[model samples]
Target: MTWNIAHTAFPAEHRRFRAVVGGVDPDAIYRAVHEAGGFRSWDEPSRDLLHLRSTAIEVYRVGDRWVLAVNGPSVEAVREVLRLLGLGADRDVQELKGA
Candidate 1:
């Protein structure tokens, strides 16, 4: 399955990244995140929250897509989470200003 990374909002605190991933099962993604460690159950029924250092990652499913919202004090921390999610190689990430 191919994963298409869409726009990534900057100002890092916005910490939002969107992707159109198909053919891949969402359960596989959840398993990967959980096995990667530091993931805790989110109060939201279908969301998983991961804390990495000073960064926080929120993973949720939206329709046929997946959204990753990250909140942190630094851009690097946010990028680190993206990398951990195997999304670092996505070259189409448009950095939205004031996001």
Candidate 2:
């Protein structure tokens, strides 16, 4: 299975991989990311934006789906975060594979 991913126009020193997440609680995902040596570098629950440093990831809710953005374009990092969220490998997508 493949998740939808988008590349933002926002410029940074490195690339960001934005992957769509489904069938998961945002709060649970936040806790999981935190427990996995990730710190809440930025968060605005009112706007559904959460950014995790060290882990270099961000998750934001858009309509019915959640978008997971990984700084530095790390597929393994994305996969690891999904795993931490209790999502199986079947949820893996390659939009960020070569980006």
Candidate 3:
């Protein structure tokens, strides 16, 4: 289903992979990114943090840009979760895949 999350997050921009992540909380952000599709591989600046187990997921940068995912789990139950996160959106039949 297509959650209206795009509107709440990026009122100025249409729905896109980056907008969702950019709007959501940073906590477990890596997982969100991972679930989306792909992610960046953390480098030296993050090497020390890895030893501390502080980050959620591994990341790496590409050409001075970090790797990112464009795919995440379905919008199923997304409405509630997004609201819990203080985002404005709605889930509906249209959001469901192969409905």
Candidate 4:
């Protein structure tokens, strides 16, 4: 499946980059994130919900999509996680302003 990642610059306390990712299997993505050294910060199996965070990024499910928030202004870290999550080299990324 093609992944659509819409990212924006959101400067907040420890949150610099934010993105919405579509067309992903939450279960597989969770595994990928976990394997990539991300810790489970939140989990609610009754609702099929979870949140994973590493040193630089946090990933969580929202509806049918996954939301990725970078802890700092580390664009490379974002790309790395997406790669680990199985996004192809040819990725569909939409850069937004004030999103």
Top candidate, metric TM-score: 2
What TM-score against the true fold does each predicted structure earn?
0.50, 0.54, 0.24, 0.51
TM-score of 4: 0.51
Local accuracy of candidate 4 as per-residue lDDT tens digits, 7-60: 988557443443445546657766877787665556664223333343344455
Candidate 2 wrong stretches, greater than 4 Å: 1-18, 47-55, 64-72, 96-99
**Tens digits of lDDT, candidate 2, 1-99:** 999899768554454454455445667767877676566656686234444543455567677776665443556666666666576535544544344
Candidate 3 lDDT, 37-89, residue by residue in tens: 43445546422111111112323344554432222233433433333334344
**Model 1 agreement with the true structure over 1-99: per-residue lDDT tens digits:** 999999977663554333333333445545656666756556365566666556566667677665666555555656665666666635233343464
**Alpha carbon deviation, residue 54, candidate 4 (Å):** 4.9
Q: Which stretches of candidate 3 lie over 4 Å from their true place?
A: 1-76, 91-99
